[model samples]
Target: MNIGIIGAGAIAHFLLEKINRHRHENLRISSVFVRNKEKYRLLESAYGVSLYTDLEKFLDSDIDLVVETANIDAVKTLLPSVLKKKDAVLISVGALADEALLTEISDLAHAYKHNVHLPSGAIGGLDLLQNAHALGTVTSVSLTTRKPARSLIEEDIDEAKTVFEGTAMEAIRQFPKNMNVSIVLSLAGIGIEKTSVRLVADPHIDKNMHHVEVIGDFGEATFSITNNPLPENPKTSYLAAMSILGTLERIGQKIRIGG
Candidate 1:
């Protein structure tokens, strides 16, 4: 599968290295789209892919899939155009918290016969949550995320503190970069407004911790995951980048583990 990446950040760099190491998978990065050509000029020779500043030229490349490792602004601006040409893998799942933008992308994907894949970022038990929701038995879903103070805020704190508590939609609006897992959980089990979220900044822990609880007619399930932040980026979890690679591998699989 030929892939086009939309950013040149830490996740994009990690993905390029992994894909280069696993060239036998037949996954080739055909091109990259970025705003500043000079800033990412080194990636061209390192990854052996063309970089285009123009959206039209980038979309016109020989790419069957587009992986957006960019931020919410890129998703809001560039993703619709990408879906019109090829399928997309969105890493910024928090952007979908906007109901209007979500509907717009959904309509565009439907109109173009394209798939918008959202990777389960930084957490697990999504398959169970989805299955429970499929049976229409899921009553409530809640997520509590705890991260190091540096990841959550610029100020150094001596003690752990609860930063924010609200619905998934509100959480996303407040902490756009850190609350993507809450949005992903909300999408898998319930609507954003119906899903509750809590964010905490802890000085005691160095890892990013997520606690998910789901209740339903079937039973109650609670999941706790502690993830190390990416080496280059503190706001992103290493597991989240691995999940993107997993999602990409699943694309060409003959039999998918989870539908």
Candidate 2:
């Protein structure tokens, strides 16, 4: 599997290190695309992969899969074309909040015979949500995300404050980078308008915490995860990067597990 990565940020760096640790002879990084050529020049020598600052050139490379660890804008602009030629693993799941864009990607993938894989970022139990939805019983879905006040509102507060309470779509608009989990939950359990989301600014906690709940005729499900943020980027969960790596590792495997 020849892979192309489309970011040079914290998640991209961490993901690369994990890929190196679990080095697969078949899984190889063929190219990297970053906006800043000088900033990520080290990647060329470190991974022995071709690096390109140009999007067109990067897309022209011999990459079987393009891993989007970049921003939502990058996903919106770059991914549709990539899907025409190869499969993709999208970490910027929040971008799919746009119904038109999501439909466009789905159409392109179906037409191109390519797959777009979405991993459980920062939290889990999404398979349960999808399963419950499959039974036509998933009636309710909600995500309560608690983060350090400093990371949320950019200040330490006296107590935990409910900063935002709205639909998953609004929450994503409000906190584009911080609320990927809300979109992920929405996509799996219900549509965006029906899914509830709450963002908390908590002075009491140091970690990024997510509480997801689902209700249906199949029954109820609850899950909570306190994720440590990546060292280079406090807004991102370390587990999120690991989830992408795990999804990549699962590729080209003979044995399949879980939902």
Candidate 3:
């Protein structure tokens, strides 16, 4: 697996550390795309890999898969090229709220015959939702992201209050950067317009906690995960990086443990 990562931030560093620790076979990090080369040059030097401060130069590399570990805007920027190749996994799925852009990407993928990979962000049950959605109706899906006070800007948040409560479409419209889990859940079960979201900022909590509840014909499910923020990138979860590494491991070999 010759992988090209979009961001060399905490998620990139953390995932690579875990990858090196596990010692997987036939794995290579061919290239990385970072906005700031000087800030992230150490990673390239340490791994002995190519670094692309320029987006075009990075996309031209002979990497097999492009894993988007960057923020939402970066994901939107690199999506077209990744879809051109048909082997890309997008982590910042909240960026797909622009139905125009989403439709464009979908049309392009269908024209070229590709797959857009949407990972279950830090939370699980996406596989179940995907299957259940294919059958009957998934009536309700809700995601609540509870993060520390620091995660939100003063304008976007209230002190330990429910900052957002509406349909998932509205949540994605309002909180483009913060609430990616809503978009992920929306795409999996119901449409974004139907799914719902509740965002809270709790000063008492130190970590980013995600509580998800689903109600459908299949059954009802509830999942909660508290993600410790990465030391390097406080905006991202440590588990977010780990989840990307997990996906990369699964992509390489047939040692299928968990589906």
Candidate 4:
């Protein structure tokens, strides 16, 4: 598979290194698309991949898949065009919080015969939630996220604080970067309006923590995960980047394991 990347950030760097280390015969990173060619020229030389500021040229390259590790703004502006040309692996799951945007992307994907893959990201238990949802048995899903104060706010804090509590829709609107996990959980179990979320900033903890709870006819289930931050970026979880690799591997498999 020829892969194109849409960002020149930390996740993009991580993907390039890991893919080179693994040397997957089936996967080759062909190109990258970014706004500032001059700023990101080093990435091109480092990875030996073509970098294009022109979206047209980038899309015209020998790429079968495009991995978008960019933000929600990039997803809104670039994804429809990408899906028209190639299948995409989207890491900015929070963009789907916009109902109109989700509908538009879904329609585009259906019309173009392209698939938009969403990774499980920082949290798990999605398979169980999806299964229960398929049976119409999942009644409630809630996520509580605890992160270091630096990740959530600019100022130093002496103690833990509940920053926000609301439905997934509201949470995503408030903390777009930090609450993408809630959006993923909402999509798997219930609609965003029904899925609850709580955000906490803790000065004492080092890891990004997530607590997920589900209730339904299948019974109650809870998941707790403590994720180390990526060394290059404290705002992102290491597992979130790893999950993209897992998604890429799964894409090549004939026998799929889970939802």
Candidate 5:
């Protein structure tokens, strides 16, 4: 597998390390997209892969599978044509909040015989949720994210306050970089509007916590996840990077359990 990565951010860096650990002899990250030339050099040295600042150059390479970490803008640019040639695995799941865009991509993938892969980034239970949705009506889905007040909001001279409390649609509209889990839940169980979302900044909590509750014909399902934050980027969780690794392995396997 000649893999290509679209960003050199924390998740990308961490995933590359794990991929090396997995050590599929033929599977190598052939190319990476980075904006800065210095960053290209730095990442090239670290990962032993060729780096590109240009999107077209990276896309034209021998990459068979591409993992996009650069978010919506990158998805809009890269996915359109990539779906024409090969499949793309997306980390920026929040981009699908736009119904038109999601439909467009979905249509393209179906037409091209390729696919868009969505991983359980920070939280889990998506398999159970989706399957349950088939068996029973998922009447309501709600997500509550609690974290250190400082971690939830911006830093550097900002007063403390709980910023976001609204629907999943609104959260996706407001926070593109964060709130991917909300978008994922919305897609899996229900539409974005009906899926309830709450964002909190509690000064007391030591770790970033995510709580999910689903009410349906079958009954209720509740889950809580305490995620360790990534060292380089506090906004992303360490579990998220691990999830990506697990997802990658699942895709290549013969019989993926509960995919």
Candidate 6:
């Protein structure tokens, strides 16, 4: 599997490290795509792979899969081209909250016969949520995400603050990077408009915490996860990068484990 990576941020660096540790002889990194080559000149020199700032040149590379570790806006801009040719793994799943964009991606991927993979990022029980929704109608879904106040903003907050409380769409709009898990649950269960979200900036907690609650005809399900922040980037969870790597490994394996 010849992989092409997008972005040169913390998640991208973490993913490259994980891939190197896997030592998968068949899986090779073909190239890297970034907006400004000058900014990541050191990364380009260190990796020894072809670095491209041009979209057309990157798309023309011999890449079987594209791993996107960039922001939601970058995903919105670059994903369509990748979806038209090769399969892609998107870490910034929040971009799919836009129904029109999601529809466009779906249509393009369908036209090209390519798959877009969304990993269970940072949180868990997504497989169960998807299966439950498939079997029966899910009445309600809510996500409560608690993270360090510093992660949300640079200014210090002494007490736990309700940073955002609204529909998934609003939360995504308010906190694009911090509340991606809410959008993930929304995609799996209801949608951005229907799925409720509560974002809290807690001064007491050092780690990022997510608590999801779902109610349906099937039953009631609740999941809570406390994730340590990535050392490279305090705004992101370490588990977020691991989840993508896990999905990549599963793609190469023969036996299926989850739904």
Better of 4 and 5 by lDDT: 4
Better of 2 and 4 by TM-score: 4
Q: How should the candidates be ordered by lDDT, best one leading?
A: 1, 4, 2, 6, 5, 3
lDDT of 4 by residue, 220-246 (tens): 999999998888887678999999888
lDDT of 6 at 215: 93
* Predicted structure with the largest lDDT when compared to the true one: 1
Tens digits of per-residue lDDT for model 6 on 1-259? 8788999888888876666444556666668899888888776556556788987788788888999988898889999988887899999999988889999999999999999989989999999889889965899999999988877867788999998899999988888777789888888888889999999989998898899999998899998999987888876788998898888878888999977
Model 3: colliding residue pairs: none
Model 4 TM-score, 2 decimals = 0.96
Error of 1 at 135 (Å): 2.6
* Cα-based TM-score, every candidate: 0.96, 0.95, 0.88, 0.96, 0.91, 0.93
lDDT by residue (tens digit), candidate 5, 108-156: 9999899788888889888878987996588999999877777656553
Candidate 2 stretches greater than 4 Å from native = none
Candidate 1 TM-score, true structure as reference: 0.96
| Better candidate number, 2 or 6, judged by lDDT | 2
Q: What would the per-residue lDDT of candidate 1 be over residues 1-259, giving only the tens digit for each residue?
A: 9999999998998899889645646688879998999999998888888999999899898989999999999999998888889999999999899899899999999999999999998999999999888977899999999888877788889999999999999999998978999998999987899999999999999899999999998799999999987888876789999999999999898998865
Q: How accurate is candidate 3 locally (lDDT)?
A: 0.78
Q: Which stretches of candidate 6 lie over 4 Å from their true place?
A: 153-156
User: In model 5, which runs have C-alpha deviations exceeding 4 angstroms?
Assistant: 21-26, 154-162
Indicate the TM-score of model 6: 0.93
Better of 2 and 5 by lDDT: 2
TM-score attained by model 5: 0.91
